[model samples]
Target: MVDNVSKQERSNIMRKVRSQSDLENVVSKALWKKGIRYRKNVKSLMGKPDIVIQKYKIVIFIDSCFWHACELHGRMPKSNTEFWESKFERNKERDAEVNKHYLSKNWNILRVWEHELREDFDGTINKIVAFIEHAKK
Candidate 1:
């Protein structure tokens, strides 16, 4: 299917798309305000988790619904359906692999979907807080 916009316009729009850590920063800021400390985008970790509390051995991932194939909100693009489907499928497979890596090491992982944060910001924050608290035990 042909897109409505010109090629250049589409390129420009895609260029402006948010980088991976944009949502991660927002969540990190909130956690900071709550007096929780964490490291952002630590490269040593598998999948480079968005937020890491090294002291508690906890890693947090703020996954975009579209990218991570959230069951409720993930929708393949109308155009390039096969391409998008394969891309998302790979993403989910990689996520599961990352989870397994951490789980084997006895690390606590908290995955927060984009929609979860958007639909209930405070609730999402509370959930992370609870996870941190529980992991501390």
Candidate 2:
């Protein structure tokens, strides 16, 4: 499918997209306030996890509903349906692969959906804290 924008324009637009999202920053700040120290988007990691605590071999992923194709909240775009579908499918596949890789290495993996955080921010943060604490054991 041909893109609506020129290749250079599309590249410029895509380049403006930041690796770390505001949602991630919010969650990370909350976790830090709770005294949890972690690294964000470690490029050396297989999937460049959103949060990682090497001390506990833990990794947390903050997934967006649109990007991760959340079962409850995900929706297809009216335009470029096929491209979006393929992109989402590949995202899901990569997520699965990353989970498998971490699990094989005995790393604790937590995937929090965007809606989960929006619906219950405190609860989600607590869950993440609990997950980290449990991994400490």
Candidate 3:
């Protein structure tokens, strides 16, 4: 029984998800400290990549599990299955387009789910580092 303000608050809460969480931030900081420089939230990019390393031509996207439909933890909401599935599918298609576009342009793309960030901070960073390092060669 929520009123307008409370309903709006709940909607806002549900709709909110930041690009760079503390886990990603910490990993970015560690990588930076080790002499890695990357651009954060480059709007010029089609997908607004979360992190970009120009030197290695690498772009990172910190995708939300709910939005990107993380294969593991992305459960279809039972409340509004049709609406949620459509939304999630659209997001997935858009992600594929962005990834393809970047690949065509010779830019390496990295998409890490929010769950991955929470579960494995350093390991996730390592995956990105490995890609960038390989591109560096």
On lDDT, the candidate that comes out on top is 2
Using TM-score, give the best candidate's number.
2
> For candidate 1, what's the RMSD?
2.2
RMSD, one per candidate, in order:
2.2, 1.4, 3.3
TM-score of 2: 0.93
Cα deviation at 115, candidate 1, in Å, is: 1.1
TM-score, one value per model? 0.86, 0.93, 0.80
lDDT of 3 by residue, 1-119 (tens): 22335667758976785655675677678779767788887788798887888777889888877778989888886665677889999999999999999999998888878888679
Per-residue CA lDDT of model 1 for 37-86, tens digit only, reads 88988899899898899898999999998889999998878876776888
Poorest stretch of ten by lDDT in candidate 3? 1-10
For 48-102, candidate 2 gives per-residue lDDT tens digits of 9999998889999999998999999999877567989999999999999999999
The deviation in Å at residue 99 for candidate 2 is 0.4
Considering lDDT, which of the candidate structures 1 and 3 is the better prediction for this target?
Answer: 1
In candidate 1, stretches whose alpha carbon ends up further than 4 angstroms from where it belongs are 1-15
Segments in model 3 whose C-alpha atoms lie over 4 Å from true places: 1-11, 14-16
If ranked by lDDT, best first, what sequence of candidates would result?
Answer: 2, 1, 3
Q: Candidates' lDDT values, in order?
A: 0.89, 0.94, 0.80
